[model samples]
Structures are given as C-alpha cells and as structure tokens.
Target chain A: MADVAYLPGLPRMLPALLPADDNSSPWRFPQYFADHFSEVMGWLWAHTWLSVVPVIAGLIIALPIGWLASRHKWAYPPMMTVSGLLYTIPSIALFVLVPPLLGLDPLSPLQVPIALTVYSVALLVRVVADGLGSVSEETLQAATAIGYTPVGRFFTVELPIAVPVITAGLRVAVVANVSIVAVAGTIGMVNLGLLFDQGFKLSTDTPYYPPIVLGLLLCVLLALVLDLLVILLGRMLTPWRKAVRS
Target chain B: MIGNVLRWLNDPDNWNGTQFTTGIWAQLQTHLLYSVIAVLAALVIGLPLGLAIGHTGRATSLISGLNAVRALPTVGVLVLLVVIIAPHFHGRTSKGYIIPTLIVLILLAVPPILSNTYAGVQNVDPAVRDAAYGMGMTGPQVLWRVELPNSLPLIFSGLRSATLQVIATATIAAYVTLGGLGRFIYDGLAQQDYPQMISGGVLVAALALIADLVLALVQRYTVSRGLTKRFSKSTVGGAVAADLEEAGVEHT
Candidate 1:
C-alpha cells in the first residue's frame, strides 16, 4: 500500500523527516502530520459532508411521512414497523445493497450517504411521529380555536414544540452516521475511514499508529462537534424552553 | 439483482464446507459467536454498573461519558486495535485478530445496555419504591423485586440495540481477517462480485432480523404480566413503539 504522504500534487512538509516507506521507524505523530496534512484535511472534509448530508436529506424526507403517521392512527403502526425493520438491516449491508438497487456503481461514493439516509429516515420517522404526537389534544384545540390553518398550526405551533425531540433524533443520526461512514472506508469508500484502511494495510509486519490515531481523534472530534451543534440548534429553535427555565 | 442474490444464496456450494471458516454456515456461526459473546460480556460488565448507578444514584457522569463513547467509530477502533496489538503477538497467534475484534465489539455493545439499565432503574416509579420500602423491603430487595421488573422493557431495548450493533460490527471484522459474513462482502468487493456481496448483505440482514425478532419474543415473555396491564391502554405495537421511542430519546 502506498503511503498517503507520497500522494502527488500536495506540497510536502518535513520530507526529510518523513518515515520510511517500509515503516522502519516507529510512528511519529508530528512527522506524519507534517507529511500528510493536506491529505488528512481532505479526508476530514469529505467525512464531514458525507456524514451531515444524509441527516439533512433524511429529515427533509421524513417530516411528511412522520406527520402522516402521527395524524392518522392507522398509519403509525405500519410506518414504525417498516422503519424499525429498515433500521435493523446492518449498515454495511445497506451500503452494498443500495448501489445495485439504485443502478449505481458498486463503489460509488454516493453509496454510503444514501444508505445513511435510509437509517436517518428509519430513526427520525419514529422520532418525528412521536414528537408530533406529544402535542396535547388541548393544545391542538387551542391552535384550532385561534383560527390557525392546519398547515399554519403545524409550522408555528407543533413544529416548534417538536424541535427538541427532532433535534435529539438528529444528534443520534449524525453521530451514528459519522461512525458508519468510517465503516464504509473498510470497503474502499473515501472519508476519514480511509485513514483506518491505510493504517491497517501498513501494519502487516509492524503496527502503525499515526494514521489510525489521527483518524480516531478526528472522528471522535467530528462526532462531538456535530452533536453539540445539534444541541445548540435545538436550543435556538426553542427559545421558549429557556424562557420557561429561566 | 434480487434474483442474482437469491441464486447465490440458493447455491449449496456456498453453504457447505469441511472446515470452520469455509462456508456460509461457518461464517454465520462465527458471526453469531462473536456477537453473542460480546453482548454477554457487555451484559456482565454493564448490568452491574448500571444497577449500582441506578440504585445509588451516584456517578451519573459515567453514563454521560459512555454515551459519548457511542460516537467512536467501530471500524476505526477495530482497525487501530488490530494494528496496535497484532504486532505484540509476533505473528505466532491468531489472538492478534480475535482480541482486537472482540474488544471493539464489546466496547461498541456496552453503552446502550448500561444506559438503558440505568434509565430503566431510575425511571422506576418513586411511588412504587416507597411502597416497597414501606413494606420493610431492604434496598437490594426493592431493586430485585420492584425496579428490576419494571425496568425489563428498557433493559431489553438496550440489549437489542447492542446485539444489533455487535452483529453488524462483526461483519466488518472480516476486514481484519476474522471470519464471518463480512468475508463475502469484502471478498466480493475485492473480486468485483456483486451477487456475492449482495448475498452477504442479505444473509446478514436476515440474521439481524431473526436475532431482533427472537429478542422481542423473549422480552414479551419475560416482562411481568402486571407491566403489560399498565401498558394495556395502547395496543402491543404501540407499547413497543413507545418503549422504542423512549429508549432512543433517553439513550441519546
């Protein structure tokens, strides 16, 4: 396997100090970082978008379906069942199966994001339905009595109230997607997961730590940031929550 | 594509082999073996800690920390462990692969179980705990007799989530040369064999569904009848959905 440090078109830093191609020298974080900084940033960039896009796409798609499930008593059971079953499918399986179903190349970069969207939808559907369902009957009547149209009521009243729950679901989806995207790297998808793949491949005779450690750090960091972002977004969307708390 | 996957699955050659790790049956066995072992080990560790936390209401910070651990990518951990630990064995033992894989699987499986158990115990109605204390039950007695029973649904929810995660991760274990259904997916990718890859996907999906179904049934049987009475206002499906919803909300 080729070392990421040797990848073309990136201006090298600390080339003289770069670890041997055979990995003779033990892992050094500074040397590795200097040698492959651009490459690492590229992986992180890909990782961020690959993970975040699916949750956004899934949330967009799930809202109407979840609203229907909450509104129609009969729709809730089947909707939950389908999503639950979908959620049960191993993510790797979904990644591989999705490409064929969609007539895309088996190794398409799109495979993972699409597969994750399935999961986000699977997860958020239940969250959305339950969040919307949490609105009390009296609250709905109040909205109606105030002459808000159903659409207007959903947008102004029910949706705002549902923000915390929906954001909670988004947090889970985002964090889980961050990890699952790395798993796709095992099958050759590009992302922070590729660093894991590279590190593993480099470890035939001796263990390599730099790439794996960097990947782990960046992944955990990404997940935490995304999680905090979702929480902050949740807080921003529900100002009344803080107003009541204060 | 479905036909191709079906044809690949229907082939007897894929299902039979003379040695372990040689066929679909062997891979299935290996996958389940790893998953079940990881879940059980997590249960041993997580259940106790969760019980103590839930019972004493101390060290709640540990639960939050464990929830953050959930965000660690499983494949990265598995590969890192393999890379870091495999060399220590000097190529003389398979423990290099097996140890790291199990560690990752167990690590991945523990959070949900621990948190759910804690939540289940904590969520036990205070009124009921008071009644148990009023009846002269000791703390341990109350935990065993009252909180544990009420906490069954959430505990099982955690168990199911962990099991599903372990099974899925065990498939990724094939990337590290551990034998399982993941072999088909990885090998298929290496060889560009889509049917075989899809077959692996189908088999894993089937395995996970069956495992979840079995766990659901076990939960249905194990939960006390009185608890069912409490949820009787909703249909069984609604009850399960409600439980699932709560599990997701609380665990996250």
Candidate 2:
C-alpha cells in the first residue's frame, strides 16, 4: 500500500498518469490495440520472464533446503515453520520491504522478481519436501539394496518418483508467480499491469474499457500458456506415468 | 527504528479521537470487516458448490475452471473492476471503491475454500460413507452429519488460508483511496516515513498471525477428539501443503 511517488532513477514510464482527456474517448479498442500490439507483446514477454525466472530461481534454491527437510526428521518442523512464516508476509509489504533489506533502489525492477522468488521459495520448499516424502520407502530400499550410493539413489530413484508431486508444486508456483508479477505493475514495473494502471487512472471521470479488458485478457492468456507449458513439460519428463495409464 | 514505530503507535494524538470510532482500532475494524465479509461471501458460494460437487461426483470441471481464477492477479482484477464499475455509482465515490474491492476480495477467497471442501469430502473414506447410507441416513443427512464433520479440518484450513489472503489483500484497497491500516503504509511511503510504513507492515503481519492462531484453535475445539488425534501429527504447514496439492489437482 505504499505511495507511488515518482523516483528519478526509474524510467519515466507513468502510463497511468497521462492526461485522461488527451485521447478524448472512453473506449479506443481498435485503434489502441493496433497501435500497441508490439508494445503489448513486449509487456507480455517481460511479464513471462518476470514470472518464470523467479520459479526457476526459487526451485534451485529450494531443492537443497527441501531435500534437507525431507531427509532429516528433526529438520521438518523447523523448516516448515520458517517457510510458512515467510509465505504469510503480504506481497505489497514484501515488495516494499525488500528494497531496504537488499539495498536496492525502491523502484528497481529487480525488487519484483526478488520478492516473487522469495515467495516461490517459501511455497515450493514445503512442496518439495512433501513430494520427496511421498516416494515409497520400498522403492528407496530397493535402490539402496542395489548398491546405489546415497547420492546416486537420490538422483536415479527418489527424484524420478517424486517428479509428479514436484511438478504439481511447480504448477502452483508458476501460476502464483504470474499473479504476483502483475502486482509489480501496480508498483510501476513495465509489464501488462501498466495497462491496468492506465485503465484505472484513465477512468477517473469515465470508464475506459479497452485497456482494462485487454490487460485482463493478456494476463489470463499468459497464465494459461505458462500453465500448459509446465503441464506439458511434466508429461514429457514422466513417460512412465502415461505407460501405466494406457 | 522499532522504538520509533512503537513511540509513534503510542502517541496520544495517534490514539486520540471520538470514542470507539477512530485511531488504529477503527482501521483494524475496517480491515477485519472487509476480510470477514469476503470470507463469508466465499463460504456461502463456495461451500455449497464444493459440497455438491463432492457429494454428487459431478461438476468437477467447474472446480478446475474456477481454479484458474487463482492465477488472475488480484490488483489487476481490483483495478479493472473499479474502472468498469465505478462509473455506475457516479455520485458516491466511496461506495464505488468499496463494492469492487469486496468483489475482488471475495473472488480471491473462493478458490481455496471451494477446492479444499470438495477434496476433503471426496477424500473421506468411502466405506464410512457406505455405512452411513446403509444406516438409513438420507443424502443430505449423510453430508451434514457424516461428511461435513470429517471435512472440518480441511474446511477450516481453507477458511484460514482464505482469511489470511483476504486480510493481506485488503491493504491494497487503500491504494484505490479506501481506508484501512494500509493508509499508514501508503501515506508513510508518500511522506517517506519509514517508521510508519514499517509499523503498518508489522501490524498487518501480527493480525494475520493472530487470526491464523485463533482459527487453528477453533479447528482444534470444533472437530471431534478422535479426529484431532488422527490429524494431531499434521501441522498447519502439512495441511497447507495438502491444500496446495488439492489445488493442483483441481487445476489439472
């Protein structure tokens, strides 16, 4: 809920603050879409990157922590408590808090992704730990009995079985990231959220339909595409599941 | 910094106002009012739908479709709805903001409640369900007496998550010129008042934690003792993890 004061180092990209009457219409669907197609695409691309990079980064960071929590009985409660607490912090608060904690400029684009990555880490750590825990003990014993080293067994045996659950976690994280990234736009990051901000300010006197509708459509489309990509990737990685199914 | 925030909070001027109608208490009330109404709205809509879906084994695709709504950005949705709906209430600006804010809050709260309730009922042991039916309980009776009780833990978990989410998000309502504890953070940010902003953040977090703790206790006392022992080993984190898995299933 922090104020939206303009900062010097940030780009002078106040789309919402543009004079509302400059365009002189409440709706400009055809003309606006035609003129901003490439620009919209660019925002979509940035939005995709902003949402996905955090999930990837978070996964990398969470893997070891998740493994630790799953492997050690004593670690599970403490690990879950810490990560759960981390998840409860409000997104807006976290966005503002991160600047001071990380020594970044308040309006830096990096803050959005960093805060999202923290969220993804918090959400995924428990998922990863739970997914790993879901692997059957007998399967693990079989791997161990086959003279596989602990590391080898984990890589070859445990992780493979854990893929389905981990993929589910990834799906949730990716979708959540998509939503959180839009919040960044509210904070002045250059993404599809700019359209929302513009639409909001533009409609100060009269409702502006095009930008708001377009922003919602594009945001949903991007989310669906990313979600489908994760599902497809999951399917590709787990061919045995299909074999078992058919 | 903490002392400064504490001092600011304790300031007589900050606390002084008309009796029972101003200061931090009023903002807390507004925040709680928004969150409670939204959660209740979500419950009214989601609980029945989830129960129906779980009981009948139909309309599951509806749940999956609704799950996608979770990915819709809350802020964007709020702004979009405001722009679309605000003009209708041309004379009353505050009502315009409040209506869209409540709509968005309800939208955000519905999914977890819907999904968890459905999953909880569906996941109930089938043998128990069959036994209840054999004992001459009607469908509604079984759902009310048997399934609902069993699903209490998950339903409570969903409500807890939904309440926390709504409370956190109600802060954004302040961005649209509505009043809540978020006023402090936003106003402080504008004035570059770090202590006030940080204090707002702390207060909101404290509220969320307290709300969660209270719900956990409610979950403890409301469910039967046997059910508690059955799930005693499962912590809040575990319940949340399970809920996330249900969410994934609903999406898929």
Candidate 3:
C-alpha cells in the first residue's frame, strides 16, 4: 500500500480515480490514473446497474407480499418459510440453478442480476413482513373499527406505519447487494472483484505496481460509500429512530 | 450401475468385488464431510470469540474494527491476503490452507456470532444475575451459573444461521484450489458436466438443511432442558420468593 513513493493528482487526493461510463468519444483520464480509474469505474458501474433493478423489483414484490402476510397468521409462515429457503441458497448455486431451467446461459450477464434479485426477495420480504408486524395492534383495530376496508387500511394506515421498517429492510438489502455483487466477477464481468483478481495477477507482473494499490483503494472506498448510503438511507426514512436513540 | 459389491462378492458378478460408487454418491460423501468440517470449524472459533466480544465491555471498543474486517468481501479479501500468505503455505496443503480457511470462515461467522452474543448478554434478565451474585457467587461464577446459561439459547440461534452460512460458503474454498463440494459447482461448469453441477448444488442445499435441523434440535434441547430465558425466569422467581419471605416483608 505504501509502494507509491510520491502522490500527485488534481490539486489534492480525493480518490476520484474512476470516471463514469460514457460513449461517443473515449472518456479518458490522465495516463497515470487511467488504468486505476477504469478498473474501479468498471466494477462500480456494473454493480450499480446490476443492483438497481433487483432492489426496485424486490421492493415492489416485497411490500405487498409483506402486507398480505401481515394480515393473517396463515399467510405469514409459508411466505416467510419459502423466502427464507430461497435466501439460504448460496448465491453461486442459485446462479447455477437458473441456467439449466431458464435456458439462460450460465455465462451471461443476466446471471448477476437474476441471482442478486432472488436473494433480495428474501430480505425485502422479511423486512416487509416484520415491519408490518410491528405496527401497533391498536392502530390496526382502530382502522378496522373506522370502517376502512382492508385495502384502505393497508395503504392509509398499515403502509404508512410500516414504511420505516420497509425502509430499514431496503437499506439492508442495498448494502447486502453491494457486498454480494462483488462475487459477480467470478462469472466474469470486470467489477471490484475483478480488480482484485487483476491486481493479484499483476503482483508477479510488476513489483510495487500502481494499478493493484489503486484497486484496493477503490474497493475500500466503494465499501465505505455503500455503507454510508445505507446509514444515510436509514436516517432519511426513519427520523424517529434518531429521537429514540437520543 | 455401481455399488453392487455385496452381490458381486456373494454370487453374481465376480469372485473378488469392490464396487465404485456413481458420481452423485461420491459427491454426496464429499459434500457431507466438507459441510461438517466447515461448520465445526466455524462454531469452534466463532463461539469463544463471540462470548468474549459480548461479555467484555472493553471488547465493545473493538466492534468497529471488527465490523470492518467482517464487512470485507470474503472471497476477494481472502484471495488477496491468501496469495501474500500462501508462499510459505500454499492453499492445497493442510498446514497452509486449513488455517486460512478457518481464518476466512471465522471472519464470516464472527459478525453473526458476536452480534447475537452481545444481544443475548444484553438481554439477560438482570434480576437473575443479581440473585446469583447475592448468593455469594464470584463474578465468573455468576456469568457461568446465570449469564452463560441464560444466553445459551440465543448463542445457539445465532450458530444455526452461522453454521449454515459456513457450510454454504465453504464452496469458495474451491476457488483457491482448496477443493470441496463447490468443485462440482465451479469445476464441473468449466468441464461442462451438468450432472456434477446440479449434484453439487443439491448437496450444498441438503447440507444446509441438515445443519439447520441439527441446530434446531439443539435449540429444542436447550429450551426443554431449562437452559434458556424461561428457566432462568422461574429460577429467579424462586430466589426472589425466598428472599422476600426471609426479610419478613411478605403479605401482599
């Protein structure tokens, strides 16, 4: 890590070593930073796109299912159990499972998103179920008493009350996905995991090399950013948690 | 059409017979061994560290550093660190690989173990601790006689998930050329063997299921044998009843 005897960049060190993906013209960095930035950005970009769809799709699937499961004891157990089982399947295995049945090639980029989404299903589902379960019983009874229909109760009363829990779950899902999606490189898209593979490969190629250090820095930075986002997401959604903590 | 050694030996096939198992059965034996070793390794390392991390106030100071370690991408970090570490001890040999696998698995297992242990210890009913302490018990005795027993169920609960996780993840060992059931999953694909791939996937899942069942049974045993919160509550109640009557402060 201390291999670089000198440090110089635009004014100061911000670790802005990666550029956003663009087309039409080659988006390039200074020769020194280019290799480092490209690898970092490659991973960051692939992971972000791979994660976004699953997260959004999961939220859509999770919230309603959680709401329905919350309504009755009969529903909760099976839904939770199945999702739990799905979640427990190792991600790699899950990725492997899809190809034979779905007719999708194992090597396809689709494996990354599909496997991640399957994992997210369980997290989001549990979050939704737990959040709605946590809504005060009295509020539920009052909603019923006030002649609110089941659907009305869900949207107006249940959902509003449960948003914080769902939010918490989504925060967890996003962070977990970020940590997890690094594995996508095993199937071979140049992500953060790929950078590590590259850096490791580079070790015998060049001693005290630049790209390897840059990759490690980017990975740590990526983790920090994702972690901060989860925290910020929690704070944004549930201000009451702040008050409670205080 | 293998595994007819008895028939071959007795009557039909050959004078001397020892049958080789089919691919799936061979893989099953391998899977079971790997899962058991991986889970056992996790529990052995995870439990004590979990206990220390939970019980000691000074250890709480280390959570952030520990969490960062825990948060590291398990495969990537291990792959990177292992390369630097492996020159002296390569991944294939027992001396080189076992320690690293244990290290990675321990890192993976500790977060859940520590979280549960800390949560469990925090949730131990205070009155039970007080009663044990009041009985002229030493601090260590109180922890063992009261807190440890009280937290056993929670610890086991965490272990359930952690053990399953370790079993599932032990597949990553295959990537480092430290082969396990994951070999069927990864190496099978590289070789284009679908049955090997499917068999490996199923074995991992089955191993996970069995691990969970065993842990669940252990949880049941702990709960039934009176090592959990319910038993602690009742015992604490008895002590309280004795103390109150001794003080002559009864008659509600």
Candidate 4:
C-alpha cells in the first residue's frame, strides 16, 4: 500500500510511519502530526503562499483597472461582464488551462498561483471600482480644493475612504483562494490540498481520517485567520469610521 | 495547441465507447444530472429556512454563519465526506462516491440561495408590508404575495450564482471517480494528454457560460419588468454587493 507512487517530487508522508506497536484507530492525529511535522509545515507553507500572493498581486493589478471603471461610467458594465465571465470558469479547468496558455510546464506549481491571481483580479476589479465609486463627489471636490494633485488625492483621500469596501472584497478573495488552492491538488500541485489527495489515495481498505481532517481544519483555520487580518487591516485603515461609530 | 484541441474534439473515436455512458454526451448528461439534483435539494432545504428567517426576522444572526460556510474548501469538503462516508457502503458499487459528491455539491449551493433569499426578504420595503397589512393581508399572505414577489430579483441572482458555482464544482466531482466533463480533464492529466485536458476545460467553461446565459434569460422573463429595469441600473454594484454579503464578507 505504501508503494503507490505519489506525484513527482511530492514527499511521501504516510500513516505507516507511525510506531510499530500502535494498533489504535486511524484517528491518531496528535501522533500523526508529531511524526510528520516537517511534511505538515511544508504543506502549510506552500498553501499560504499560493493562497496569499495572488490576493496581493490581484489588488495591485486591479486598482488601476477598477479605478478606470469607476472613473469612466461606461467601462463599468463591460468590465463587470468580462470579469463575471472569467469567474464562471471552474477553478479546476483554469488550473489545467493556465499552463498551456502561458507556455509553462504541465506540472508547474506556478500554475496554481497564476490561476488564483486570475480569480482574485476577476473578483477584486468590481470591488475596487465600487469602492472607489462610493466616494462622495463632495469629498472629491473638497480634496481638490485642498490643492491635492489628482494622484495624491486618490491615494490619500479616495483610497482611504474606499478601504472598508475594498477590504470587504479582499476578505472574500483571500478566503476563497484558500479553498481554491486545495483544488489544485487534483492536478498534482503541492499544497494543503495534497493532504486530501494523500488521504484519499491511502484509504483503500478503510478510510484514512487523519490527513483529511487535518487538511479541513488547517484550511478553515487559515481562511478564518486571513479573513480576520483583512478586517483588521480595514479597521486600521479607517479609524475614523470606528471613531464615528463609537 | 489549438490544432491539437480541434483534432481531439473532431476525432470520432473520442465521442464513442463500448457503452453509451462512456461517451462525451453521456458524461455531459451525468454532469447536468448531478448539478440539478444538488441545486434542487439545496433549494428545497435552504429556501424555506431562509424565508422563515426573513419573514419573522428571528434567527437572522444565523445568516452570517451560513455565509461563512462559503469559505469551506470545496475540494476538501468533497474528499473529507467521501473518505468518512465511503467506508459505510462496504465497498459497494459507486454509491459511496456519488452520495458524497452530491452532498458536497448541495452544501456548496445552499449558502448563496439561503442568504440571498433572506437578504431579499429582509430588504423588502416596509411600507409595502404595512400597505399589505392595511389591506387585511395576513402574515403568511404578506410574505407569500408581497415579500416573495418583491424579492424575486435577488432570489434569482442568488440562484444564478449558486447554479454557476454548482456547475463548476460538479466538474470537480470527476476527481473522486464520478462521471462529468471533469473526467476528460483528470483523465487527460493522468495520461499526459494536454489537448484532451484543454478541450475538457473548454467544454466545462462553455457549459457554465451557457448555463449562466439561460438563467439570465429566465430571470429577465420571470422577474417583473419594472424591477428588472431598476435592478439593471444598479446591478453592476447592487448584485456584487448582494453576492458579497451572501459570501459573508461583512461581519459588521
């Protein structure tokens, strides 16, 4: 059972590595985590990068596009339509399609992050546009009256006001990306998703519960943490909202 | 790559097998079957619960919890369910795989439908409800006639979004050895057949686009024209906001 090959370059983390004297049920999570520390951390590290870098990249890419959409009212509909169409494509399909489109290798790990970045951009463009659009015309006029340049005013006044809205979009994108990274395991990309694949592959006779449970726990936990971080960032960026509420 | 995809799609051999279920047509049917069943099941369960929460305004806090459910990884939940439940079938024919796949898809679908319905109902103009009450409409009658009708645009948007998500996930059902367009991608990947894999991506994407288009048309016809026009004006922002709320993006 241990001899079945894994995806190339994937470390063979297995239940069989446990102590020989153990005869307990497959629910031995503490023991499993203790034994496979490096492997678990490795999965977590890869999962974090794949899930996060995309959101940051997407934000940077989307800001200008989203700003353009907000500025030119006519650009809003067509841009939203295109992004909506992009969003409808399944994550799994995008994972497979990305490599060929970019001339990357079939098994390249880069595909997962690139695919996720596409999703992030698709999701964020609307959020950024709407966030910026939410800025009151009066506020813009005030900023201009203060002699702030267009670019300066955008960064200092418009962007700060848009924080709550954009961050709301960021929270969703980050959380969604966490889950999507797991789907990459199906295509042999390494991440926490590999745990699900490993668990499935190992469960020939009876169900292997440890890795599956671990993967789910880690994923939900990661999503929750990342979500809270976005909320915190949003709060920090908009202390005036908090001040007004209080 | 385009030639490879064209040739692979054009190949007669790729379209047939010893049994009808082995063909692309059968696989497409299977994919739709799984998606429809899951969506219908979720609607039956979620619609009423959401409606109850919306109508009475009790237990509305539960909506946030439901929205958070969106963050659960689809692939993780699918694999976890299959592993936990498959053993109960004692290695019986693919019931093990199918049941779990359906469950995951159902779970994937419920949140948007439920949250959207709740938001839709909750967002109904209070004046309309007061007018209905003044006309001697009972509580249930108000919900059924006034609230439900008013909320159709949002409900339909929720349904469309849910349907699109369900279709995409149904493709992943192929990963667990179920039949769908995903089979082409997964099978092609395993065998290192890039054209077959890419074509599978094209087919799944095309199907999602068509499904979304059909739903949009249905929404256009079914929703009142006045509401549709009003929604179209702000839908670029409104729909995304509704979707974001349904996703539980705003805790405050």
lDDT of each model, Cα atoms only? 0.88, 0.81, 0.64, 0.86
Q: Candidate order by DockQ, highest to lowest?
A: 1, 4, 2, 3
Candidate 4's C-alpha lDDT? 0.86
Candidate 4 similarity to native, TM-score: 0.89
- Between the candidate structures 1 and 4, which one is better when assessed by lDDT? 1
* iRMSD (Å), candidate 4: 5.2
Instruction: Give the alpha carbon lDDT tens digit for every residue of A1-246 in model 4.
Output: 364454221232244434334433355656667777899899999999888999999999999999999999799999999999999888888887888789887668788889999999999999999999999989999999989999999999999999999999999999999999998887888888888898889887666767777888889999999999899989988999988998
Write the residue-wise lDDT of candidate 3 on B41-150 in tens digits.
66676666666666665577555566566445666655655544444443446544455665776667766766676667767778877888788999777766677778
**CA deviation > 4 Å runs, candidate 2:** A1-30, A37-39, A103-107, B1-12, B15-22, B230-252
Top-DockQ structure, candidate number:
1
TM-score of each: 0.89, 0.85, 0.75, 0.89
Residue-level lDDT tens digits of model 2 in A129-190: 99899888898899899899999988888888888888899988888887777776765688
lDDT, candidate 2, at B105: 94
Residue pairs in clash, model 2? none
Lowest lDDT sum, 10 consecutive residues, model 1 chain B, at B225-234
Q: What interface RMSD do all candidates show, one decimal each? A: 5.5, 6.2, 6.4, 5.2
DockQ of each: 0.44, 0.29, 0.19, 0.42
lDDT of 1 by residue, A3-87 (tens): 6556332233134225655443334655676799998889899999988999999999999999999999899999999999999
Better of 1 and 4 by DockQ: 1
